[model samples]
Target: MIDLHAHSTRSDGRLTPGALVARAAEAGVTTFALTDHDTIDGLDEARTAANTHDITFIDGVEVSVTWQRRTLHVVGLAFDRGNAALTEGLATLQQVRRDRAKRIAAKIEKLGVADAWSRAQALAAAGQITRPHFARLLIEDGVCRNNNQAFKKHLRPGRDAHVTVEWASLDDAVAWIQGAGGIAVLAHPFGYGFSAAWRRRALAAFAQAGGDALEICTGTTDRQQEITAARDAAQHGLAGSAGSDFHAPEQFWLGLGRLRALPGGLPAVWHDPRFPGADAAN
Candidate 1:
């Protein structure tokens, strides 16, 4: 099976890159991509592990994007990790994330977590303080029960710990991925909870901005979400991609390579030879 999206300790995930690849290999994932959030630091380790397991590793990143003031993710696959454009672009976004994380820490401080940033940093392997780190801190401090509750009660918009950071634009994100010889895919097209009309407009804008595909089958998607994303991909002339969005073993529903296949009549992302492991995937 082919899973075009997942994460590791290089980002918010629980496993190391090697462990991630080992697990994917065990799960029969022939084509795997470690699309960590705004970073490619784990690619070397992941690639080495994939080589050992005979699994094809695709250089990937889930780029954070702000479209019309709403945060969304764009998955870049089969990219050159050394390309200056993509490297520098992701670095810029990394700083943006750090700043937002600090702001979140400041907000959480008011809720009596004085060392919020420090605590969150301790949990992050690379010092990349993500919202999940904060969520973990909240859980440890008895602020929330779980990841979902942490986001809903503390971190999401209108919450006390919420902090909004303006991420890269759609055009720039797509350009960075393409410039690095990668395919830019809209990640989880329906997960943002936008209205149907809004999703249509956003999908059109993504296509116009040169996005190459959309995830028609994501880890968290239901039948309605999959069907809608597939229709959106077709209407915009984009390819269909499947991603588990796997972060950790605890998130069982998003186990490595656990995503459903694309619905009938949709063109898969690996249909293009440029996609990593397309030969084996097809």
Candidate 2:
């Protein structure tokens, strides 16, 4: 099985790159992508572990993009990590993330969370600082019962700790991915919380910007949703991609390589020339 989206300690994920790859290998994933949020720092370690386990590793990154004033993720797969355009773009995003983290910490501190910034930094452990780290710290301090509660009470949009930062534009993100010899896939469209018309407009904008695929299955058991995504992909002349979007081991519903297969007659993202057996029919 192939999993085109995942994370590690390079971002907010719980596992180190090596451990994440090991888990993917153990889960019978023949091909895996380490699409860490806004950073490719974990790719080297993941590649080494995948090599050791005889798994095909795809170089990838999940870029945060601002589309129609909303935050969305665009996954770039099979990219040249050394490409200057992609590297520079990611550096810019990382700086924005750092600033956003500081703002979030400040806002949460005003709400009576002592040493919030320090706690989040400590939790991150030299990895990228993310909202999840803050959420985890809140949970540990008994401010919230779990990650979901933490987000609901503080981190989600319009909440106290929600710091809005402008991310790269969709066109720029897609261009950076394409410039780096990668195909851009709109990650988990259904997760965007947009109306059907807005979703269509977003997809059209993405396709116009040179995006190559849409995620048809993202570890959800909803067969109807999966089929609808596939139909949308076909309608837009885009290939279909699947991923678990796995972050932590406790998220059993999103286990690696265990996602439902893409619907019949949909073009698989792996059919791209960068992957082996690309010539084979999907």
Candidate 3:
């Protein structure tokens, strides 16, 4: 099976890129993508390992975009890895992410979470120190009971330490992916808590923005949610995509390629003209 959405230590994941690829191979994943958050440093190592393992490695990265005042994640698959525009855009994003991380650290410091910022950064080992890394540190240091507690009490948006800044628009994000010779797929549509009407509107907007596919199956979304997403994709004429969104072994529910099957009646978004195999759709 193909698991297109994954993470490694290049961003927030626990495993190194090579180890992540090796684990996916052991999990029976034949086609995989290391779509780490806001970074492609893991891709080179993952690609090398995929070659050794005889697996197909689809070039990917998850780009964050702002739409309608909310943060949305868009996954780019099979992009030209060396495209200058895409690389420049991601470099800018990395800087923005670092600035935001520092702000979060300062906010937590004011909240009397002593040394949490420094400790978290040290734990991150010079990689991107995400809110999750902070949350885990808080949990380990007895500041919070667990990762969820850390976020719920101190780190969620509009709370004390949340500081994710809007860096790119949805249109520009999709355009970058397409311009880099990739297919842009909306990641985990329901994560934003959009109403039915809002979802329809967003899908229309995304399609117009050059998005090629919508993730119909991902992580542990239920069958009903899958059907809902599949129907929405069909109505909007989006392609179908699936992935595990896997991060670590502790997240056993998020096994490689673990996803509900797409409802059979829908026209796959991968069949859209933007995909390489679009002609086979007919």
Candidate 4:
């Protein structure tokens, strides 16, 4: 199966790019995409690993975007990994993330957690510092039971430690991905929890802004929900895709390379015109 969505340690995922590729091969994935959060830094390692393992790999990135005041994650697949414009945009995002992480660390310190920044820095170890790194450190220090607890108690939206980040606009994000010769996909539509009207508006805006597909089935979403999302994509004349969104080995519920088939009657996003001959390439 083609698992078109995933992450690596270049973002909040537990594994490195090469490690993730090896794991996917072991898990029986014939094709995969390394859609790491907001960056393509992991692509080189993943590509090399895929070459070694003979797994068909797609260059991908999950860009964090803002639309109507909500965070929208758009996954760009089959991109030109060496595109200069895309790399420049990602560099800006990485800087924004660094700033947000620093603020989170500062807030945690005021809550009597000294050395939080140092702790996160150490844990990140030259990797991109993120809220998950802080969460992991919190778990290690017995401050929180797990990453979920840390997010719930300190890092989630509207909490003291929650910092509002300015993500790229949907149009700009889609343009960047398209410029990189990628198919832009709407990642996990249900995760936003939007109203029906809001969802319609979002989908219309995405199509207008040049999005290619919607991830109908992803980890944590049920079959019914997946069907509904698939229908939504079809109604919007978009293509459908699926993935496990795997992050760690222990997340059995989200096994590596496991994916539900896209709903029937929907054309594959690989054939969509929003992408530069993604269908032809595949």
Which whole-number lDDT from 0 to 100 does residue 155 have in model 2? Answer: 98
Question: lDDT for model 1, on a 0 to 1 scale?
Answer: 0.88
lDDT of 3 at 49: 98
Which model, 2 or 3, shows the larger TM-score?
A: 2
lDDT of 2 by residue, 1-282 (tens): 888899998898999999999999999998899999999999999999999999888888999999888988999999899999999999999999999999999987877778988888888886899999988778877888999999998999999899999999999999999998898999998888889888888898998888999998887638898898899899989999999899999897679988888999998999988655566423
Candidate 3, which segments miss by more than 4 Å at Cα?
267-282
Candidate 1, 99-181: lDDT as tens digits: 99889899887776659877788788673788888888888888788989999999888888898789999999999999999
Q: TM-score for every candidate vs. truth?
A: 0.96, 0.97, 0.92, 0.93
Candidate 3 clash figure, as a count: 4
Model 2: CA > 4 A from native: 280-282
Candidate number with greatest TM-score: 2
Please identify model 4 stretches exceeding 4 Å from their true place: 271-282
> Residue 198 of model 2: what lDDT?
87
What Cα-based lDDT does every candidate model obtain? 0.88, 0.90, 0.82, 0.83
- Clashing residue pairs in candidate 3 (N, C-alpha, C atoms within 3 angstroms): 238-269, 239-269, 239-270, 240-269
User: TM-score ranking from best to worst?
Assistant: 2, 1, 4, 3
Q: TM-score of the candidate numbered 3?
A: 0.92
Clashes of each: 0, 0, 4, 1
Model 3 residue 157 distance off true place after TM-score fit, in angstroms: 0.9
- The alpha-carbon deviation from the true structure for residue 21 of candidate 2, after best TM-score superposition, in angstroms, is 0.5
